[model samples]
Target chain A: MGGDFGPQVTVPASVQALLQYPELKVILFGDQSAITSQLSLLNQLQHPRLSIVHCEHVIANETRPSQALRSSQGTSMRMALDSVSDGQADACVSAGNTGALMALSRYTLKQLPGVDRPALVTAIPTNTDNKTWLLDLGANVSCDADTLFQFAVMGAVLAEQENSASPRVALLNIGEEEIKGNDLVKRCAEMLANSPDINYIGYLEGNELYSGRADVIVCDGFVGNVSLKTSEGVANLFIDSIKNAISTNPLKRLVAKWLFNDLFISLKQLNPDQYNGASLLGLRGIVVKSHGSADVAAFSNAIGEAVHEVKRQIPTKISDRLEEVLLERHY
Target chain B: MGGDFGPQVTVPASVQALLQYPELKVILFGDQSAITSQLSLLNQLQHPRLSIVHCEHVIANETRPSQALRSSQGTSMRMALDSVSDGQADACVSAGNTGALMALSRYTLKQLPGVDRPALVTAIPTNTDNKTWLLDLGANVSCDADTLFQFAVMGAVLAEQENSASPRVALLNIGEEEIKGNDLVKRCAEMLANSPDINYIGYLEGNELYSGRADVIVCDGFVGNVSLKTSEGVANLFIDSIKNAISTNPLKRLVAKWLFNDLFISLKQLNPDQYNGASLLGLRGIVVKSHGSADVAAFSNAIGEAVHEVKRQIPTKISDRLEEVLLERHY
Candidate 1:
């Protein structure tokens, strides 16, 4: 009843997740008939550790955030978030409408203290073996100096956990000079440089995102989202262009049979679907937003990310770091 | 002296440009002896149309904009710009420091009235036969709604002149919806929609930049620079990864010879060098900034672009449009 393919993909992905994690339990919240039909098709209707809470209302993709919050109490997306808030579930994952999902999760769990709005952070693969975590994917379009500073702190905490070390952070800017960015970015850079709690690498240009100059790159949601989407667009153009070129003639097509073998293996390594889940940071509970167009394998990866976040206690760690910074300021 | 290769590339490139346009005359601005030696090597030293201006001062890449404006009067970069300002040359092209060039040009010629600062706009090849022009490459970091609207008008004029038709202008944002961007971007969109001169298509996402949906895309310099640089980084990464994969095996390497034939052709067509010159729009005189690491061919393309701008009378047309816009507002 949600996402592009709804239970068709999520149900199979859940079964796959259950296979991977033996101790896992799943409570699906969607139309009973839709869930039953799929479960019965796979003969998983009587599977142990799986339950369905019949939910009639579905949050459509076109539903506005305000409308969803006003009348989506019984919606699957809302119930899933509520399950996490009420301690019935350890974490929640959804491929529903992003705006509605964010609104409902914030409305249900409320933002953590000292956080105005949660930012979306996702891992983008770089030329280096590791990936860079970019925050505010499309959360807050325009941010003040303080809000940007807060994103740095939150992003640093997440990157530390994600990288299993103290992450080197840099403000995303046009140039690497102290005078390159606007006043807001310059102010944020100065504050981060003076702070002693994190590794604050001054400024990183967009060309440096995949050049592996920083572990965490922070910017306002508008720039972050545009950069991320533009990267994807170029990548698609590259691959599609190659495919069309290979298909242009029989000789190239013959070569593509083997050429595509290793080409795809490398391409698969950089697939956006392989890194589908984006964490809604600064929220009180864990909520992972899977790309709406994600398929079974991609949705499975999102579920895995949710499981990993729950185990890592990422929110708790961020809370502690925030408190430490706040108490230091008070002192 | 400023770019990576400097006169070694520039001198040969100037010779190549002169060969293409026989009526073209060049004034070499740098050390007289170095220019003489390079010209002799190409048998271009005594060419009647080629003249050498002995200028010992060279602008270093590391020079700050303020320092360049205050003390770089005698430097080659500044002299080249002066030639254009005095109407001795049709236009100026340089592979020098971008910040310094922008500063020196603005200070020497003065900005057009009603223009705060000029923006860096470059043509990017798209899937379609035509190219898209993205502005504020790394010039102004933060722009108000009025500034953004100005970019649209400037970009629209440039695109119309470049494409010989009214170009579709768009505001680059995270989403295509009207509610997608910040307050500033939203307000700018509204003004563009109401404007009757250009074809305003409203909001466009970053993914659509290379999709050839719009002819001119506008954004704050920070986002524009990042998007441009990020696209370059990804394109490089895509090619490099495929090269590594193909080189891993002998069979793949053999196929790559023939396999890479059309692939390289398509890539070369999309090469940034082929579209090298970035126009510094909103200035009284025409100036083009070439990539610092550009080769002889790329530098030649930049020079060609400058000549084209001079012939097209782009700056005069933009000035007229600005006056028209101002008069409309006055009424």
Candidate 2:
């Protein structure tokens, strides 16, 4: 979560995590004064597990992640990931900058064997009891047949770890037809249909993904990012639209008050914060990327997700499965 | 509006249009029996201005629009555009296939001067008093800087025709900053920022398009399509989530009933049918494309839009402006 706002959000979230789970340990990494000030605001002066790693300077807006990482050896996010890579920290979570996080994690941890491009995987609540996992939401925009196939395998393994025993995978396409969508979707479908490592359920339209037809959906980063943002925009638009409509008229206002709680709960369930962090699948170590705008609740959820990924050893299992599938396909 | 599920949706909508406005005239272009059968289902069938143009066949699903135009001579959609080109009809509306509509219109009507690609412009209802116009939602996915500039001009012209005077146009990008987005958006910003033809207000993020920041929002078909679909998906998800949350408990159910009208009105405002048809901007004649799943309301709206476009002489005005701009740009 290489976040733009930095320690302000992360520090409070760290304290909240400790309050929720007594055993939970959090390390605050950022500008020392900024982290201490945020924690002080929360009345968390000091704790056994909570500690701060001081980094006087910060990455500027114009500095690329590689440039920042190479120049600043002890940046907050970098140090956190380094902890994970060196076995000091089980997993690392950030709600900062996405590109920075991806670059740092990939460079430091290295890509998993047989995985060409790592994908950003996030869960979206669906109509069904089970949540649907969408991948490459903004990781790799352009993907080949092999990259897409590997994404499906990795996504399936991640879903299984999340709870699904045999998660069904579907390629995001314009239409359900085997021949529909751009060249990439078409090629990916052909590969997924033949791949034996994952339970590929065939093609799914953008609309059907939320309709709860499949558990795991995969696409190139360009389409995925657009889809994800589109979803978020629509959700915000609806809520705002409803709120405006309700406040407009007297009769509607009365109705709105009665139905407010129901709507609130329903909207809460769909909140991006509830499904806040995206796992950087195909990385050697567990790296959960939270949204830059994530609040305390969202950050806590992301930290919990990071903890789960480490405890389950999901990366190792996914890598082993990916290698077997790649070898079989190659031979 | 050449749609796969034509005649059934369009015929009723055509009748509804006539019923809504007694002065309106409708000419259905499709299989005669299919049109007649639908008309027979309506109570007031006999009208002096209502007529039909018989076409024997339609473009099949597998046929690309360009391929269909080259091979299928008697397709209904192509024939409808021919009616406009030949002055038999003032404008054409279809709930038929989109690709076929694009291909036939581009071939028959040709492009307005200076317009490289004819964009599909759709209106989305926002919280503000005016509806937001989103262009090239699914017309041309891959476009260059020049094409985007043309799209902005066409979109702005269409918006003005639709009663938006001095319609502000904004290039949709990943971020609002001029430097944000990919190469296409960046170059488009430079062109749009300096272009005398458009009232360019700079870049708008995908999320802020609904905030009423700009009247006309422009993007390539790929991004536009995803944005439109994503908005639809999120809106649907929000409604579903709210409904589920409300019904989960009795207390919430009471609140939901009170807020039902507010929610319904707001959701209805966001409904695609309200802003159903997308004008194929830059075409020689007025051509409106409705969604394939368009019901009676959407089709009727498309017909209404066609009538409005014809009355406003949008195509002619856009062509005149584009010609002027093209000459100035030395294109």
Candidate 3:
């Protein structure tokens, strides 16, 4: 994983991965000694499935992804992506710089057919039986009507695979009303409504998403990023607030104990790390982007998700669906 | 107070005002009987301060404030704002259309000097000891460098008045590094860093807002709106998740009871309603905009806040500060 604090966290994570999945093979892509030092601390050592691919060069936290990738050929993050592109690995995962990861993947691997831009897609648990999938969480800031429509298509496909059944897609607007958003959302609504490939359920306000309105929500990168981050901040805020309320006064603490189950379920649903990495949709290969602050458990979960995506052949399914949509478009 | 749903929520809220502050005067601007009926339900009969102006007209939800005011004269929200402008009331509060409120307020009340656009400022409770004031939360979608700089100044002033002494203002960027954001954020950073009006603390990444980086966080409307909503969504998600987790198995629920105080405090810290209603800064009068879903408690708290703003003469203070900043700009 491409993280700021490298193998310090990844080493324990790799060991945890082995424990979770017996058949899993983990190839560490960082400084050899750093990886070795971390792995040596683990109780289980010298597992055949665990291997290290050392790329001595490191991408400093301050370095821009584009500049780093252009200047350093041996950066661990770049090498990991290269391994995926060159078929040395089935998929790649990272918890390092998000912008750098996006820039590197877009520049190196390139976009898939009919995919104008690759979006960061994550599954958010909803009140419904199935979770909701949201896209363009932080990949592209500016987007047009057509791009959003494409996001709906991609998000729907991802949701179908992840949550089962045909996922209903909705455009994330300021309001549920078609006429209630800025110019971008209005045009996007029109385009998504016209598109036949998506199971478009029309527009949903930001607040309605948590109310379990739809299975897939699509928006431009700016809005999606804010929504995703806002959700994280609010979740953290809620957890913090609850803790303070219950602990600050003695009486409330007793009440809190009785309502503990109710509160825990609520707080856990909002942790971004629990959901882990978002899938880089509309890419030729299955790539997952984890949060920069992701710990060992989060990274391992991302890897597990990556494995699931690869096994599911999500890319192939998306390609086939896009081709069908394109054929229908010509008609 | 510019919200999607007004009168229905506001009328009841106005009645609840009496309970919170017994000496408060409430002049209902909508149809006299409509508001009276709501007040009557609370068993408040013939209170000297509770009065209503007969106005049958309303600004439609879709109508822009400029258009609504030009075309319609008797809108309840418009009349309420007129009460503030004409000095009929100490402050104006609304849960009606936000765009309409902004448009009407800007047109009727006018902006303070050196203020290009009046921002919607609100205080969200963070994990830190002090609450953070975020401005331009949803006022203007697109803003220039100058506009953003003004927002920072006004946000800081608001933060200070809200009890944050020597408030530190931070420009909201994608990353915390000096060079790590889009062109707009970069330009804003330079302006904020150079500005004498605000206690500029440099940049804050989206994820770090909750981590207590700064007291006042400033951004354009698009980013601010998304961030605010996303925070709300995430809060809800966390509450739901924690509830599910605690109840997932009987054993976890038992443990959850013991940790209830910690959990509840954290969740309460993120309650959006507690921070409901953003002030329209840079305006002639104190205009507070509460959320459409604001409950009786939120409404009561908003009324309390309006009283505080009126007592502090926030508008005059902001005006004086703006003059000081502008004069410094000339020198």
Candidate 4:
């Protein structure tokens, strides 16, 4: 059992994923009875492509990483990651605690060679009808310059998989000037600029995030997390403003009811459901973390992302590319 | 002399402020000829309440803080701040380089007693029709726990001047849990919890920023700046999305042209011009930094903010309150 709705949402989402991808096999690592009950409701209890492994413990959303790591022997999150590490599963997806997920994934699956830390990477929608990759989203709260540089390397390798030969890597800073940012960001900039493998852009401020100026934006976990969350907050405020505008008058409300459907269709690119999954990058095994409050459709999107990553062999490519870049730079 | 349009924007803004506030007097520091030319255009060249102090040097926006500090003897930004220090002006407002302004203000006006560093504080509009104060917006990139605690103290004091005796102060972080954030934020949280003067409300994530759950949010300049700019980016993206939606079809364009005015009026609170001023808090004298690209209306708003801070005697109140709190906590 995991996430807010546990098996009720996860089982349905997994069933949807199984229906969508004919060759995809899913292994549910949670309470067998709970999974069976939900699968039974969907008439998928004995689906040929689906299996279940009963987990004795479940990680709470509030559990600290350290606490979860200590008693994570038979937990659902631990067993799922174990399936990937043991070569039984191609990838693992979970709508559970992010901190515990990262901690357990690091402990069970381990980091890729030359990767000091695993960063949480996600695709953020931009105004240019494309997405930019943002990394270190609360994986490591504080990162040294060397750690940040490694994140840029991993981020660039990940972005290159999206069809760009050499992704423009940028350090997320307060200003675009050469003299802006602290010692950590400045040093990281220097490292990225000198690396021949990375197409290092000088700096990108937060306002330029949605301009699609860079393919990969890297920063310490704290700044990345705040920027992502702040975007959500502003989006919510804007949506609320629209709702209030339509509700204040009867005529406007009627007009909105007539035209809102088309408006939403036009703005479909801004949908959060499509961007639900965040991959734990730099790990040896693929682990996709879904939003805790995700619904069936959103969780299904997370499963789709994991399948995509597995098909692309993201982890292997990141490992090989990082090694080549490091060996060349003598880093 | 300073900012993008220099005296062209600031002069007309000064005239506007003189018109709005009959008892107010404005001292403009820039090229005398440029200031007079703009005032002459508005037919206020002989205005008694307005005076101009010509400065030979000007600081470019690209200048670093350290570089600006070295050669800022007779620059427009430095002279404006010096007027406040010498009691020639009650407060100062500039639409110039943020870093240079911060350095020169700290050098001329100096920090209030018990204050380690002055912070850039601004009012962000929330959905509740009230604004929340956010501080350390790119003032100090990397802050220790003690410095962050001082920002909270100064933030609370500033918020109190806005008619709230006990403003709920919150530390901005990635998560709302006690175990979240870096060591600096954690240590600052502990200090805030034990202090009797502050109304500490624990951690606040970025998504909760606009929910009005906290009246004042404190963080290091790096995170605060990123959050603020990210919000602006999101807002711009949403606006662009709406524009794209309306322009995609002829019928929608016609409808938008008819109703967009009313919709914009309803969303007037989201306008950036009204929130153009960001005060440099914890300083002995009031110094409001306007957006560099601000027009006349936006620059006038900055002057209005300075007058409000002067009337409230924010600096003296902040200095006194911080001393009382520090003394009570034996800090």
Q: TM-scores across all candidates? A: 0.97, 0.89, 0.86, 0.96
For each candidate, the DockQ is 0.65, 0.38, 0.33, 0.60
Could you tell me the TM-score of chain B in model 3? 0.90
* Candidate structures ordered by DockQ, highest first: 1, 4, 2, 3
Overall local distance difference test of candidate 2: 0.77
Clashing pairs in 1: none
Interface RMSD of each: 1.8, 3.8, 4.6, 2.2
Which stretches of model 1 miss by more than 4 angstroms? A176-179, B176-179, B271-274
Candidate 3 per-residue lDDT over residues B148-254, each given as its tens digit: 88888888787887656788998776542322555677788887677666789987766767767788998888777767766676666566566766676786677
Q: Give the per-residue lDDT of model 4 (tens digit) for B1-331.
A: 5778888898888899999999899988889888888989999989999888999989899998889989998889889888899998989899999888888899999999998989999988888856789988898898898888888888887777773889999999996242389999989999999998899999999988878888899999989888888887777776787887777778767767666666666555664335889999988999999999888988999999998998889898888888898898895
lDDT of each: 0.83, 0.77, 0.75, 0.86
lDDT of 2 by residue, B24-123 (tens): 8787777888788878887545767798888887876556776777875787778878889999888988776677778889899998777788988898
Q: Model 3: what is its DockQ?
A: 0.33
Residue-by-residue lDDT tens digits, candidate 4, A200-241: 988998988888899999999989988888777777777777
Predicted model with the maximum DockQ: 1
| Full candidate order by lDDT, most accurate first | 4, 1, 2, 3
Better of 1 and 4 by lDDT: 4
For each predicted model, how many residue pairs clash, with residues at least 3 apart or on different chains? Answer: 0, 21, 52, 0
Off by over 4 Å in 2: A1-8, A19-23, A33-46, A60-67, A141-145, A175-179, A248-258, B1-9, B19-23, B31-34, B37-43, B58-67, B70-75, B163-165, B175-179, B245-258
- Compute the lDDT of residue A50 as modeled in candidate 4: 95
